[model samples]
Target: MDETLKDSKKLISDIQTQYTRLSKGQKLIAQYILNNYDKVAFMTACKLGETVGVSESTVVRFANALGYSGYPKLQAALQELIKNKLTTVQRVEMANDYSDENTILNKILKGDIDNIRETLEEIDGEAFQEAISRLLKARKIYILGMRTSFVVAQYLGFYLGIILDNVHTVRMDMGDAFEQIVRIGEDDVVIAFSFPRYSKKSFQLVKYAKEKGAHVISITDSLFAPIASESDNTLIVKSNMASFVDSLVPAMSVANALAVAVGMKEKEDIKEHFDDLEQMWDKYGMFE
Candidate 1:
């Protein structure tokens, strides 16, 4: 890294450091980025130029002035700065601003569409396959999700439970976290979910699972996400913000895909489980 851009981690501070040296057009772009980096992170160079009323060339030049190779590097640094810091209240406010042109429903749905598109484009196929392999070989599998992510955990656990004989869903409640994870052993694997405004307890739980010798696989929004950073494997999911909600659509899609993969891997056993389950349902007249 160039000395001038070494403070990429300190985006705000670097902006301040370079303030006096920036041109008038650069100043405008710099100020907009500092004030609205969360929004800017997703903008294309052309979009960013439009937002700041500069040419795309100007935007690229501003990035070079900051000692970055190009606009993408600068934008990525901006993302890292705000990734875990944006609050739900802030997201709601952003949604309000973005929903002006479209109906709230359309606006929100479009955001989810973008999220799923981006997630699919960037998902690391190798890591995903490794995660499936880990799940298949583990002596037991523990699924964890906390707070907003609990739904994702339950979805994964319920589907995987039928495919794997030894599957457990570890609740995020502090009281239950330890009790559930205490017995995790070397041959076990833990699939954990965590997203923005990350839970400290989940972080602690993943760490504990690691200490207990479980192979940890994380499903999260970013590689920099605390849980993903510490895990042996991570599945990256794109989460969009819509009215203070972290869109779970992409996360759920990832869950369903993983479940199907695991099921196909254990098709013989799962077929038997389904057969028995079908009989039980028939016996109880459980269907509508």
Candidate 2:
């Protein structure tokens, strides 16, 4: 079991309580660290300051206000908190606190809840919005996911096609996808979903799309993913859970969010499309 930190949650909550008391520079540092905890947890004070558009002194001040000796101690504590809470492999496995049959349900629910919550907390809002915008504007949208992730890709493709035209879901057949890829142009976009133990084919497809000048957005679990290196924008969804099997809850949530954002972007079009479908269904007595 991981050693309990010295009231880390209380410390974080206290910092949050005094949020309004922070100076402008310190506030910037504080907000940045809170929003990007995963990144800041491992970063040095100078790197944290640079990333947040603040000075090193500002980072130190923010640390001191949080009741730490200095930035390093605060960073260490934050790292421990992150290591305990974040759904990464090493941290989550080490922190597993469940056993027995009744605890199985609790574990699953907690894992799903944690996955969604951490994903939302860790996501970069600007990046997410930008990805939605790109998908909305693209002439053709191609979605690729293999194995378990295929379900999310299919769901997105199905809903997105209802809202917008020219949405393609790439299947596992490499030849079929290759043929489809040839038709994609600079104005097109490809959304690829791949997590840890990522499919090589997904990486290849993303690379192929990039080479063909298609904007590629990747939804993945790690910065180390092969697809991430080739992706135009990567949305990280931390899906670390108990059991070696991956969970779909976080991926589905992200896909649903993307679908909603895309639908909202083309609200009128989606409305008209659904209206026509309803009319056609009634005319054919399809529901009766």
TM-score of 2: 0.65
lDDT of 2 at 59: 89
> Which parts of model 2 are misplaced by more than 4 Å?
1-101, 173-175, 285-288
Tens-digit lDDT string for candidate 2 (1-288): 111245444656766888999999988887876687756766789988888898988889898887777887777566545542455454445434456777978877888998899788877798798899898789999999988889899998998888887898997655667776778889999999987557888888888889989999999876556798998888888675455467778989999999999888888888888999999999999996
- Each prediction's whole-model lDDT (CA): 0.84, 0.79
Evaluated at residue 245, the lDDT of candidate 2 is: 62
Return the top candidate by lDDT. Answer: 1
Alpha-carbon deviation at 279 in model 1, angstroms: 1.5
Best by TM-score: 1
| Cα RMSD, each candidate | 3.7, 11.9
lDDT of 1 at 34: 82
Question: On a 0 to 100 scale, what is the lDDT of residue 233 in model 2?
Answer: 85
